[model samples]
Target: MKPTITITYCPKCGWLLRSSYMATELLTTFADELNGVLLKPAETAGEFCISIDGEPLVDRKAAGGFPEITALKRLVRDRVAPDKSLGHSDRVHAKPDSGKDEK
Candidate 1:
């Protein structure tokens, strides 16, 4: 069974659209893997977090900003669709390996 994905954002902070957009992205990407994606309004000021089955996955307060979409998708995919490929999302944007000689 797929886990429920929940994204809570500050409605008063005018982040409703952001939250909705994430929900849609997750739904579209994990349509067959997720039970559903929920967009919730945060009661506390400056609160934005994503959880899976009630487990905190992303917390803006702790991480100091919104999460990147690719990172979020990876988290969700791990729990809900382990075998599913995230295509471009799987690409690592990490800094170049120090061993690689610069041009």
Candidate 2:
């Protein structure tokens, strides 16, 4: 399953925004509030970026809506947690060091 919510931070201003929502609960709630416009599930992890005009509804300091945020947090956590059995290595290979003459 895809994430219900995706967020991004601005490198310059440190502002955060809602990037996407794919989870059924959040999207369905949002759609219902919008009078029945449904958001389809992604075929292969598509993006759902959006801009916030004002302050973020949720942030590092505190969660805004306790219930909704908690649900979404649980969903995101489940989606991002690495599977230990997968034995995935996160290391990146470094380029070979070049002699000064090669510069």
- Among all candidates shown, the one with the greatest TM-score: 1
Per-residue CA lDDT of candidate 2, range 1-103, in tens?
A: 2223334333343222222232344454343222221232322232222212222334432443223444443333333442312112223458888755744
In candidate 1, stretches whose alpha carbon ends up further than 4 angstroms from where it belongs are: 94-103
Model 1 local distance difference test score: 0.89
- Pull out the clashing pairs in model 2: 4-23
RMSD of each: 2.9, 14.4
User: Per-residue alpha-carbon lDDT of model 1 for 1-103, expressed as tens digits?
Assistant: 7789888899889998989888988999998888998888889988999999899999999999888888889988888878899999999879967897769
- Error (Å) of candidate 1 at residue 89 is 0.7
Give the alpha-carbon lDDT of every model: 0.89, 0.33
Off by over 4 Å in 2: 1-6, 9-23, 34-53, 62-103
